[model samples]
Target: MSILATTRTVARHRRLSRLELAAYIAQLEGQNTALIAGNTALAAQLDQAANDISGLSEDLRVARGENLRLDAALTATNARLANATSVGSLPQHVSTQPVPIVQRFESGPVLRAGASPLAAVTAPGKRGDVDKTQPLPVVTTT
Candidate 1:
């Protein structure tokens, strides 16, 4: 071909390549802008998650302290109860005398025979013809 025709052809090819390059650059710029916006949203979400974690950490610390305080209070209460029970219990060597047995019936409470107001009574089957080897059956009035 002649040099002039080749030059015109090269120029046209260059122009078309420049247009294609410009369109590709525009598409790349759009993708870059979308990436920047997505990165900004991700950063905001990360900051929110960090703030929530911080608040929850503080709450856990406070709850642990309260649990410790409650444990100490419970320990002190148990000790005090132990002391009070030990001091309030019945003392030994009060009396060895047996008290009278008062049997309760449907009508009212009645003193058993041979059981005085201040004296003691023998075993249930001792004075009766009941069996001495076998255990007596329990009786319920009410």
Candidate 2:
């Protein structure tokens, strides 16, 4: 009877140990699942940030290009102003000819075809006769 009682006690202990181990395993699996979810969320956020950074970088490049173009134009205008101030002290008289289109180069402002050279020919009062039937010349510049 004493031996039989000891066998029954050992069997009860083994059953309790198995139950504890199963509970521990279940808890560990739950923690692992939570960690995997957190990692996925973090990866998604990192991908979004990378995309935003690339977009901002492209915008910065475009802005820089536009700024360079505007700076060149401003520099050209300032040079033209300085040249005008150095050439003559008095203001020149305003002529009645059409306002000429000015092109700026590194050297200076280039006079267009119908500008200062032909000012005398194209004055408002001394203008030549316009043949209305004639087609206007189409000019192309490279």
Clashing pairs in 1: none
Query: What would the per-residue lDDT of candidate 2 be over residues 1-142, giving only the tens digit for each residue?
Result: 6999999988887774777989999999999999999999999999999999999999999999999999999999999899878845455574334433442332344556655533544445555743323223333343
Question: On residues 44-107, what C-alpha lDDT tens digit does candidate 1 reach at each position?
Answer: 9999999999999999999999999999999999998897788555566554344334533433
Candidate 2 error regions (>4 Å): 1-16, 85-142
Question: Weakest 10 consecutive residues, lDDT, candidate 1?
Answer: 130-139
What TM-score does model 1 achieve against the real structure? 0.45
Whole-model lDDT, candidate 1? 0.72
